[model samples]
Each structure stands twice: as C-alpha cells, then as structure tokens.
Target: GAGVSQTPSNKVTEKGKYVELRCDPISGHTALYWYRQSLGQGPEFLIYFQGTGAADDSGLPNDRFFAVRPEGSVSTLKIQRTERGDSAVYLCASSRGGFGHEQFFGPGTRLTVL
Candidate 1:
C-alpha cells in the first residue's frame, strides 16, 4: 500500500462479541503500532512490532486484545468479549524504525459497543 490502511473504518457491535480489524502498512516499513483513543483523550499506545517480533506489547489492556504482524507487513488486531468500554478509535501506525521516527497513522477503525 502507498500508506497505512485500516479496515472497517466503523464498526458497531453488542457487548461480548468479537471483532477484528486489519492494517496494511507502507511497503518496506519495519515498525507497526496500535493505539486506542477514547473521545477527548489522546491516543494511548497499545502495542508495537518490529519486523516479525513484537518489540512492545506492554500496553495491551488485557488478554482479550491481541495483535500480530506475521510477515512484517500487514497486521490484525483481535478483540474478544468486547465491552462498552472498548468503544473507541483503533489507530494503526507505521514508521521506518525506532521510537523517534515519525509515525504515519491510518484513518482508524472506530468500534462502537452497544
């Protein structure tokens, strides 16, 4: 892809259901990140991957959330037992490498748990 692309720009679901969102980063980029933004709040970092390894998964809220970048390219975020509290914008970003790099963000996947 020419830029970061996120799937399902908007989603509405009942509590306890599962959802999966996808992201395709710019070609040749080696770093990917996931963040959650609630209304009026800044984006909160959830996870980051470098190549095929997750360099940081410390920010994942719980076991119900997981992400994978198997080929160091496209990635998917899976949420289980969704709750009302999970309603927010799921943002995906990618950078050349390292924390200091400028991250390019997608339009984001907005999940609404009703």
Candidate 2:
C-alpha cells in the first residue's frame, strides 16, 4: 500500500527546456489525477485517468503539457519548452474511482523554471 509519490521534490530548469515528472500511485488505485498549484493557490486539475485511458485532460494549460497512464497505475507528466510561467508544484493524487472519494496527494514536484 504505497502512497502516491512524485519525483525530484524540486526541479530547476531554464526558460526553454523540457522536464518529465513521475508519479506512482497507491496500489489498487484505479484513478489518477495531476494538478498544478501556484504559490498560495489551490491545486488546478490538469488531467485525470480512469483505468488506462485519460478520462479528462481539459485542464491541461497548453500543448506544452502532456501525461500518460498506460498501465492503469503509474503515470508521468511531461512538459515541453518549459517557461518561467510554468513553474509550480505539480501534485499527483489518486482515489478509489470518482470525485466523491477522498484523494491522497503526494508531496509534489516543485518545478522552477529559471
């Protein structure tokens, strides 16, 4: 029963670079979600996956961001052409399935675009 986990606890990159953040959800979790949190702001949903398919990716800011969950468990968030504006805490969470259940969150990967 591993809890959600995110890598790099902190990341520093230049204005135009690429980064891939990884997430490992709890075992048996069928739902995974990615969210970004700006300083002092609440988490903004980026993408959500149910089983192996991405159920909702509407919250993705732009083409620079993408995610995948092929095995219905672990997931990765990739950001292309990183920018200072893209700097934020990338949070990963998982639940039983739907919205009603509580989501367990990781410590988050803090992305800093210099």
lDDT winner: 1
lDDT of 1: 0.95
Evaluated against the true structure, the overall lDDT of model 2 is 0.94
User: Ten consecutive residues with minimal summed lDDT in candidate 2?
Assistant: 94-103
Off by over 4 Å in 1: none
- Global lDDT of each candidate: 0.95, 0.94
Q: Which stretches of candidate 2 lie over 4 Å from their true place?
A: none
Clashing pairs in 2: none
Query: What TM-score do all the candidates reach, one by one?
Result: 0.96, 0.96
- Please give me the total number of clashing residue pairs in predicted model 2: 0
- Compared with the true structure, model 1 gives a TM-score of 0.96
Across residues 16-76, which tens digit of lDDT does each residue of candidate 2 receive? 9999999999998899999999999999999999999999999999999999998898899
Q: How much is the lDDT of residue 52 in candidate 1?
A: 82
Candidate 1 per-residue C-alpha lDDT over 1-114 given as tens digits, one digit per residue, 9 for 90 to 100: 488999999999999999999999988889999999999999999999999889999999999999999988999999999999999999999999756999999999999999
